[model samples]
Structures are given as C-alpha cells and as structure tokens.
Target: MSWVTLNDMRTWLVAGALAFALIALFAPRIDLTRDAYDVLAVIDITTSMNTRDEASGAETVSRLRAAKTALREMLAKLPCGSHLGLGFFTERRTFLLFDPIEVCENFAAIDEAIAQLDWRMAWEGDSYVSRGLYSAIEVAKSLDADLIFITDGHELPPLPFSGLPPFDGKPGDVGGLIVGIGSRTPTPLLKYDEEGREIGTYAAQEVPQENRSGAPPPDASTRPGYHPKWAPFGNAVVDNSEHMAVVREAYLKQLASVTGLSYAYFGQREDLLEPLVAAAHARPLKVASDIRALPGSLALILLVFLYGLGAVAAGRALIRSSLNLPPPKGAK
Candidate 1:
C-alpha cells in the first residue's frame, strides 16, 4: 500500500486495457449523418451564358465561370452523406454527365466536371430554356433526386406568348430550388468558335443568324411552328438594344412556381444553401451502420499482454504466500 509500486503500475495498465477492450467489444454508438435525399445539379452551358457580367472581387467574369465558382462553394457545403450528380443543359436537353454519388467521396471529380462545363459542350447553338428545364425535371424524377437547376434563365426566343413552360409533374414530386445567375443589365456575350476558342463579344447588330433563312436551325426546329425569334438581320445596329444577357429573375421565379420549387439568386453561396439545408432536414434519412474494428483490435492486443503479466505476477505471489517465505526485494 506504499505510495506507488510495480504492482500498482501493472494494476493500472490492466485496468486501462480492460476498459479499452470493453469499448471495442461494445462498439460505441456514434451518430453518423445520413442524407434524406440526393441532389441532381443541372447547369446551363449555353453560348449566352458566356456573358461576362457576374462580379468576382474587382473583375467581371462570364456567367458560366461565376456559376462554376459558386458550384464549387456549394459542393463544399453539401451535407455529409448526401449524394450529388452533375448534368448540363444543352440542345434543349438535360444530359447527365455523371450519376449520383457520395458527395464527400467524389468531390474532386464533381469539381472537375463543374469546371469543364462550357458552351463547347453544347451540341447545338440553341438554348431552349423552358424545354431544357422540363428535361431537367424529367431527369430529376428519373433519378428520384431533388433538383437544383442553375441558369441565367435566358431564353433564345423568349418564352413563346410570355407563358410558363408545361410542367405536368405534381407538386412535391421533388423538392428543389432554381438558382438564377446574372445581372439585370445585359452584357455582351463573348463569342467562341466551334473549338471553344474565344473570338470576340457579340455586338448589338451581330444577330445570331440561324442560317439567315428566316427558318430556325435544324437543331432548334424540332417543335412544329416554333420558329425562334431571329434577331433582326441588318447592319442597322440598334445601338440602344439591351442585347446583353440578364438574370431574368421574373422568368426564373415563374419557372420555380410552375414546378413547385423555390427560387434564389446565386450571388451569395450561403443564401442558396440555406433552403437546401431545410429541404434535407424535411426528408427521411437512410442510416448506414459503421462498426469500426481497429480500436477493438488494438485494445484486445494490449489486454492480452497486460493480463499475461498480471497472471504470471499473481502466480508467483501465490506460491510465496503459501510457503510463508520472506518477501522479495520491492515487495510492499
């Protein structure tokens, strides 16, 4: 019972090992976050999105570039265990570039995919905004994921008759938000060649000639009687024309309303993600049990060593006690 001894040290070591063994055997429960739903992110990569208006610090960047930056920030904030998929709107279709995967695990690939998005990926020179949005809804439904549609909401021929697009999906089919990106004042869109090399900005009178035949291009002539409103073909440049791309906030809001979703500006990353957090909390989480085994293994090894030493020491003490022999050096 002296201050401290070899036996005391041995006792403490054995007790510590026993505690670790118990912890490992029981597999302490930890609360691991499980996402209630997956998110399908649809990005618009049209030529008009090349308008350099979105501000980043002191420099103005293209809408597409700003969108990619915002996406990177959003991806970094995605909830743990949440699943995310990337797609792009091109040629009036939502093309799934990749399927839903764990966001945390595959963030690098997601970032790469986001960065690679550009007008060059567009199969055609048409941005049927409404049609692309409809396609996004279908894609989201097929994936059974919540939708996050990011776009400038710039329609090539402006919504025909100024009406909302057809959305048959019932409300609550999926929860999501339409994130609008752009400025109110239009900016000249940077033109690019087929190879995606930047040429120059489209001037007011530089009408996008859809073959100069008063007929929609082959790729954009899919819908019957759907001749896109061709920019007036003439050298009389309308100097006052607001040809620059704008955010189209009203159109985006209307689309969100038609689809039973929310709308938000993409200027602030946190403001956009707040609604996502609410959407995530509203769904039912699918839990996955994770039983870690390493700690238990290490504890067991220490326990074995400690127990062996304790046993040998106990056995020797017992023999000496039985014979009533003199104490060994350091015996208490």
Candidate 2:
C-alpha cells in the first residue's frame, strides 16, 4: 500500500510538471489593458547645463549628463506600448528632433538619439528658459503628447524685469512634468569652444548682471553712476550670480503653476517616473504580454522539488535497511 501510494504521488508530480512544461512550450500570450503614454521629452542644452554640480558615485557629473542618465533610465522604465519623442531647447525655442514612436519597437533608435545629444547642438547661446518651455508645450500639443521638460532653469542674458513673456497657451492645455535638474548651490558655468573643448568658466563680467529687456529697476535713478541712457541700473555694482548655474526650483515651480504642469526634482533617476506618470494623460492600450517564462519557471521548480523528495525518501529507506529495522505497519 505504501509503495503504491508513493508511486501515485510521484506520478502526479511528474504529470503536473509535464503539463506546465507543455503549456510553457506553447508560449501563450495575453492581452492586458494597460495605461500607455505619449510623451515629448525636451532637454536643455544651454551652456549653464554644463555645470558639474551632481555627484555620480565618487565622481561629479554635469547637469546635462545627469539629466541624460535620468532620461535613459526613464526610457527603459516606460512600457512597451508607450510612445516617446525627443527635442532640445536652445535660443528661446524647442526644436523637435522626432515625433513620438513606440518605445519597445524603437528603443535602440530612441536611445541612440538621446546619446547623441550635445551642447554643441545649440543654434544660439542664449537660454530663454520660459520661451523654450512654451515652445516645448506647443510642440507637445502639436503631437498630441504630454511634455517632459528637463532644465536647470538658468536663463542666459537673464529674464526681463517684466517677468516671463506671457504664456500664449492656456493653463492645463497640455499636461506634463517640469523636471528641475541641478543642485541648489551655484556653480560657475563652463565655457566650451566651437569644437566642444572646455576652456574655463564664464567670467562675471562676461554674462548679463540683470534684466535689461524690460523697465529699469525702481532704484535705477538712485544707483551710482546712474545715467538713464548709459548706466541704467548702475555701472558700479554688478551682480555676478547670473554667471553661475543653479537649479532655480522656485522659478520652475512658478512656471509649473502658470502652465498647469507638475514639478519634480531630478535628484535620483527613480524620482522622475512618479510625477511624470501622474502628469501624463493615460490612454488605455491592449498590450500583448508574453507569459511563457512564468509557467516554464514553475515547471522547472516543480521538477527539482520532486527529484529532491525522491532522493530524501531513498536515503531514508537505505538507512532503515542498514539498521535492519522493521519497515513499520505500512511498509512494502
């Protein structure tokens, strides 16, 4: 009776394992309802983004490098059905490199495109952050996709005293995330030659010290050497802070408020996805997910377990025989 029962148990285990193995061999797929995203990601390629304020392991990396790394990780995390587009911000405009494409199908092309992004691609030196963001929104709207604008919020030549140029688009017209990428502490902006060789940092005198596009400062008349025609703000005092780069979180938050977009600090690669996904408009997709490995792995585990059980039982029987002990009441 014991022998028959043991054989029956072994047969059942073998049969179950074989059944799962066959199912795995068929490699069936299932259609799942998943939220898919259509996103246009625009990166800041301004000179200020060259500021090395982020630490990667023991070595420090530039803001642009950090942003690219975070973006690469984001690409991998996006699901198969999701679509992604690429663009770069420079000279007060966002230039779209490509329209949205399916992530899984065109991952290599998308990653290669991102890897090729360079500060040298800037058509102009000025970084009009607000205008660039507005352009990004327009591009995203044209593509019917959400926007992911990554920048340190550094405005080259500085913004006008009148505040950001009026946003032509209505708030909440396009949902997206504004990812601020840099440290709070200011660091000198690195200057690079035409060939992309870093020479030195921008001097305080070389960059704009204040807003010169709008109305003069309220105290402009009281400033030293204040000449309405020549020295508007002042000729004696110049703020050098504009020459340095830092993550303007407050400014970015204000931009987010005006645009009806969510804000996120790109401190770590993992921190970007949540706010990004939350801001993205989800479109339901029928995703065909292959589940072959699930049953195949289970089948393998079952077979290994059955083999171990047989080995243990055989060893126990051998020990009983060696001791010349009775097989007990149910023994074969």
Clashes of each: 1, 0
TM-score list, all predictions:
0.67, 0.90
Note the residue pairs that clash in candidate 2.
none
Candidate 2 stretches greater than 4 Å from native: 1-8, 18-29, 227-234, 269-271, 291-302
Tens digits of per-residue lDDT for model 1, 81-171: 7788989997688999887788888989888888888777778877877789888888888987888888998776444432655677886
Candidate 2 lDDT over 197-311, as tens digits, reads 9899988888888877668878889988899988787777687599888899999999999999999998755456678999989889997888999988988888998899999
Please give the distance, in angstroms, between residue 257's alpha carbon in candidate 2 and its true position after superposition. 0.5
Q: Could you say which candidate leads in lDDT?
A: 2
Ten residues in a row with the worst lDDT in model 1?
231-240
TM-score of model 2 relative to the true fold?
Answer: 0.90
Against the reference, the lDDT scores of all candidates come to: 0.74, 0.89
